[model samples]
Target: MQTMKLTIAGKGEGDDAPLVEDLIGQLGDFLGLLREVEDAVAEPGEENEIVWRVTGATRNSPLSIEITAFPKRHGMNIDQRERKVRAAAAHGLAEIKRAPARPDWFDDRALTKAGGIFGRVSNGLAATTIDFGNDLPPVVITSETARAAAANIVRIQKPVDRPYRELGSVEGYFEGFERDGFGRLVLRLRARLTNETAKCILQGQAAAAFEERSVGEVIERGRRLVVSGTLHHRGPGRLYQVDADRLQLLRNSGLPDVADITDPGFTGGLRSEDFLAGMRDAGSA
Candidate 1:
C-alpha cells in the first residue's frame, strides 16, 4: 500500500468546483499513464474536497494508492504540484512488476505545463457521461484519456489495423431519432447483436441515404429497419461505425421500411408534469 499526499491547488474561494473537477481529472490521466489500475473509488471529504482511492493488481499481490485533496487550502499551484504527484506515483508504480510501461505520447511536462490545461481538462470530463443524480460526479478514472488521441501512448496511441472494407447490416426496431446540435439527424436502433439488444447509431450521410423513405417515419419506435452500410473502425480505440447509405423498412421482419408520410406525427401532445403538480399544490397552499 502506498499513500501519496498532495494538496489540491484550487479550493474554497468563490466558485472553485470547476477547477477542482479539472485537477482531479488530470490526476486520473496521469495515474493511468503510470500503471495498470484495476479499480478506483472517490468519495466526498470535508472542506468541499474529494478523496480518490486507486487500486491495481501486481504479479505478487494487489497494490493500493490513496490521494486526498484539501480543496480549502490556499496557494494551490497546479503546474508544480501535478508534476510532483506524477513523479511520486511513477516511482511507486515502478516497484510493481505488473506496472504498465510509460507511453510515448505521455509528456509529463506537456500535460502539466501546457497552456489551457484546465480547458482541456474540462472538455475531457464533458466527453463522458456521469450520473450526477445521486450526488456530485464521482472522480474515478475508468480509462486513461478522456478524448481519443492519436498520440496517446498509455491507452490509444496506435491506430488499429483496418481491412480493405467491411460491410455490415442491422435489422432492428427503430428506438429513437433526433437531430444533434449541428443539425445532423441521429437514428438509434435496438437490434439483437450477440443475443443482446445493441443500440446502434445511424448518422451523417446514412441518416439520409434512403430517398425512398424520409427520416420522419423512422422515428417511430418498434419500426423494423434493415440498414446496410460500409463499416469503418476509427479512433485510437478503433470503435466500429457504419456509414449507412441504404435503409429499407421491412414488414413483420423487424426491418425499417420507406417513409410514406413526408411529415409523420408532426403534431403531438405536449404534457408537463410540473404544471400539473403546481396546479394541485395551489389548493393546498
Candidate 2:
C-alpha cells in the first residue's frame, strides 16, 4: 500500500480555491494518468489491479486530497509492486511536465492519455501537484509549465500509416467470442508470441471446423488454436486482427511442424511458394 497527495491551488471568483469543474477535470485526468502509467509498467500476463481510496481531505486554502492506492491481489512482494507503481506514476507525471520533449519510458497511448493534464491549466486550473511520499519530491504543474507541456504534446510527430501484413501461422488462446454488427461471429485470439489480441475471422474450412465445438467448450477451457492468416498491425507488438483461412485446435502433443509435412497437394496441388504468391496477388487485387 502507498499514499499520495494531490493539491489544486488557484483563485476562483473571490476565494483562493479553484472552480468545481476545473477541480473535477483535473482529478479525472490525474486518475487517468496513473492508470495509463500502471498499464505501461505492468509485466506481461500480470494484471495490476489498484484500488484507490480517498483516505483524507483538507479544507485548507488550497484543497488537498490524500489518496491511498493498494493492490487488490495479495502476494509476498505486494509492497515492492506498490512502490514500483508509485514510482512509475511519479515518472509519468514528470514526463508530462517536460512535454514537447519525448517521454523516456511511456508509450504513445500513455502519453496521449496523460497529455490532457497540460491543457487543464489553460482552463483555469491554476496549479496541480502530486506528492509521492518517502523523500521523493512532488511533481508540480503550473499554468506556465502546463502551456509548455501542452505545446510539446501537440508538436509530437505521429506515423502517417499503420498497415497490416501477412502473418501465415500464429498460435494463441482463442477467447472473446461475439457477433459483429453484420451478424458475423468474431473470435478474439491473444497470440502467444505477441500477447496482442487478434480478431479471428474464420473462412471456409476454418468456419466449418469451429462449428464442431460448443462455444462453452472453447471459451471455458481457453482452447489454444493455430490460425494461419493475414495479420493487420500498425507496427511490431501492435497486432490488430487475423483473417484466418485455417484454424485448428492445438492438442497437448501439438500437430507436426510445416517443415515435417510431406504433402505436395497442400494448396490444391500448387507449390507452397506459388500458392502464397497467388494469395498475395489476390489480396492486392
Best by TM-score: 2
Model 1, span 1-285: residue lDDT tens: 123432222332443232445655545654453332111111111122222343321222111224533323455433433333344333323221122223222333333322122234335332222111122222222223322221232332233554344677865666666566776555666442211133344554465553336556665666666767765544422324445666766554422345533334433332466656766799789
Clashing pairs in 2: 100-152
By lDDT, who's the top model here? 2
lDDT of 2 by residue, 50-146 (tens): 7667899997978998988765766435666567667876875676566444453355655666677678776687888889886567888888888
Local distance difference test values of all predictions, in order: 0.39, 0.70
Worst 10-residue lDDT window for candidate 2 reads: 153-162
Candidate 1: residue 91 Cα off by (Å) = 49
Question: Ten consecutive residues with minimal summed lDDT in candidate 1?
Answer: 37-46
What would the TM-scores of all predictions be?
Answer: 0.26, 0.53
